[model samples]
Target: MIGQRRHFQVAHRPRNDDESILPLINIVFLLLIFFMVAGQLSAVDPFEVEPVESAVDGQPGPDEFMVIVGTEGRLAVNQDETDLEGMARLVAEHLQRHGDAARVRVKADGRAEAVEVVGILERLREAGVERIDLLTVPET
Candidate 1:
């Protein structure tokens, strides 16, 4: 009796299989909805570009000519690829044709540098474009 040894053991609870994954499912659905709603709803430009968004209600005029600036600063006037000088010449000719009703819409890539955009704007202004509208997507 004096040399007897005692052993001790600790009890552990088994994990329950009754845990529900409803919360996980809910999170997945919420993410799906967020993506669908937050995603871009605007029309794709001729070249791959993500334009800036605006809160204004008015849309770009249909009669106005469009000038697209690529991400790398490539210029396209009325869907015709050209340099800045060429674009200026073309826009000037168009302005003469439309007379006082001439309108120009500039759509530049969001990733384009500010300098590039400014240069394009300056060219348009030099071509006698009194008012140049910047194109943007509506903010949701």
Candidate 2:
């Protein structure tokens, strides 16, 4: 009888040194953090007025009147709604009380009609308001 040849076999194990995804994940997380901080830093306060940049730079003093024209053709004094006649009366009264030292600032909504805003301006002018500033939003 011929003697059978014996063979030895070795068990196979998977390689555990793979590290391709670790650096990618770290980079992704760092980018996310950077974007988050940048987004927060870019946040700014909403403004009602869009001031045109000018060479003249100074802060407005007190005794300024703010008139707001709502989209619905409603007139407001510092956010208080007033009708056309009522607005005229109020302006007249304000002028009488505060004298010529009052400054008027008008803020009309973008959707507000030009006629309504003009009417308000005329009323203010008739009421002896000399210093009037129109407030507008800055174009992006």
Instruction: Say which candidate scores most in lDDT.
Output: 1
Error (Å) of candidate 1 at residue 40 is: 21
Per-residue lDDT tens digits for candidate 2, residues 1-140, read 37988787988887666576788899999999999888874422223422333444344334456777766566667556677777777787778877877778886766777787888898888878988887754444
Stretches > 4 Å off in candidate 2: 1-63
lDDT of 1 by residue, 40-136 (tens): 5444455776777888755765455889888787878776778877887889888889987788998888888979998888988878888888888
After the best TM-score superposition of candidate 2, give how far the Cα of residue 109 lies from its true spot, in angstroms.
0.5
Model 1, backbone clash pairs (residues 3+ apart or across chains), number: 0
How well does candidate 1 score on lDDT at residue 102? 84
Model 2's alpha-carbon lDDT is 0.70
* lDDT of every model, 2 decimals: 0.80, 0.70
Q: So what's the TM-score on candidate 2?
A: 0.53
